[model samples]
Target: MDRVDRIRERKREHLELALTEASQSRRASGWDDVALVPSALPERSLGDIDLSAELVGHRLRAPLLIVGMTGGHPDARMINKVLGAVAEAHGIAVGVGSQRAALEVPELAPTFASVRDHARTVPVLANIGALQLIAQGERPALGAEKVARLVDMVRADAIAVHLNVVQELLQPEGDRVTGPLLPALAALVRVAPVPVIVKETGAGIDRESARRLVDAGAAALDVGGVGGTSFARIETERAGVGEGPFADWGIPAAASVLECRGLGVPVIATGGIADGATAAKPLALGASLVGIGRAALLAANDGVEAAILTVGRLIDELRTAVLLSGGARPSDLMARPPVLTGATEAWARQRGLLA
Candidate 1:
């Protein structure tokens, strides 16, 4: 098979392996012991709790959006359709994976087009790997704008410029990602003609990087932090690349949020977030929204209703946690302090971020 065929095959394998083996041991994204303390006799009304939130120029019924995964392939459209339908129904946002394949074959538009048509009336986000901003030269630059405009094409709300060097290094036919990424990113933000969000796949973002992205004109930051999908681990196993004794890699979700605190850009916490408390921790530590992927994928495989049912359950858990923390709404969680400890603390201290 050629490079293009290999990418498509890898997507299939990723779904199967991620669904099965990725669940083997609950790889700790280092949430072993950090938590937000519950408020005792707090002056807050749970009855008045609000789940409504706004981000990336769109309003959401909930604060979560299933982050980008795969969409340039035929196999992925069905999944996107199911995910999109549920996202719309629930009033959350949906982000399609890299659209490079569709760029390769305009015939593939239907695959991603299904996302806009299938979901409930919710915000959808177009996704493209950041490297694409320059790889295909002027066409890609123009394509980026066309992609940004595709929100209208698919009725999307925004777009995510995803950075995934780790995944590329591991993929068999991944392109040679070169050049200074920030300038290209800044240019995209300046001219994309849509709200652009800069996101990391799973490695986490520090305060400095967050600040830089904000300066680069990112509307928000989705710190798809470590402790969730270890793309390094995933790719190493799949494409058989990257050999550096990664007994482990990635900064945990907790540390990522802490480092990004007060950076102006809202941090979307993802990576190993599983439960109500885990969801609450990042918001408490300074994340704008919490992203759940693999867990959602597992739930989604059962069908759209099953998927939304699972997502609803998670939302309920997050709401309950928010209320008990004395937070009147999702935004209030951002004010409560999270007590970071253990490895996550060490990470904060190393960066002089722990306070």
Candidate 2:
């Protein structure tokens, strides 16, 4: 296969394996250790709750984002269409997978661009890897001009620059060079017409990294923490290797959320969020939005209605969780602090995030 064909094959493999149980991390996301205090007299009813939230200057009916997961292959076109339709129907946000593949082969542009056709109103984020900001092998860095095509192709409301160092290290054909990424990111932020969101790819973001990203002009941060679909494991599997020590590595989702919170910009808690109750934890912990990855992907695979139903159920459960916690909105959960236990609490203590 040629280089473009190899990239397409890789993208197809990722889509197939991501939905399997083997791609999931065995470690806990720290949500299980968190318990919200129930109220005896929650005066507000579920019907009165408001799920609306704002991110990157766009208002959304719900604070849920269908995290970028697929693109660059023929099959990915329909998946993007389904996900985009679901997002538009629910008034939530959606993001496409890395547009690097399309940039290499213009023919695949339709696969990623399909999102804009259905998700006309909601915020659509265009994705690219941090490695693409620097030159690798014979390929030159994707400078300001090429990056603009990424946004134009998706009609993106924002750009999500994903940081996937671990995945790159494991993948056979991954970009191995570690150049001056911060400066490139800063330059991209200066030139891009839309907000630039720096996101992790399962390893999660720490307080120090979050600070630097914010300093580099990252409009938001997606703490794609551990305890979810682990790309490390996926790469290993693709390489014919079994799960290694790094399979369950990185900061858990809950702790990462605490670490990323208090920063001025909005934080998106991603990792292993599976249900509405689980999603509510991050929102209460100061995350402006929650991201659904494998679950949404699986639902979309079943078709548009399934995707909508799955998202609708999760949103309903989120509203219910907030109501039971004596809150009229999702943000109210922050005031009623959760009682943390297990490894999650230990992490918070060591990180000095817990007082």
Best by TM-score: 2
Best by lDDT: 2
Candidate 1, pairs of clashing residues: 29-227, 84-119, 85-119, 88-120, 89-120, 228-272
- In candidate 2, the residue pairs with backbone N, CA or C atoms under 3 Å apart (3 or more residues apart, or in different chains) clash, namely none
Give Cα-based local distance difference scores for all models.
0.74, 0.92
Tell me each candidate's TM-score. Answer: 0.90, 0.98
lDDT of 2 by residue, 11-126 (tens): 89999999899899898889998888888899898899999998799999999999998899888999999999999999999999999989988999999999899999999999
lDDT of 1 at 321: 85
Per-residue error for 136 in candidate 2, Å, reads 1.4
TM-score of 1: 0.90
> What value of lDDT does candidate 2 attain over all alpha carbons?
0.92
List ranges where model 1 is wrong by over 4 Å. Answer: 2-4, 23-27, 42-46, 136-153, 240-244
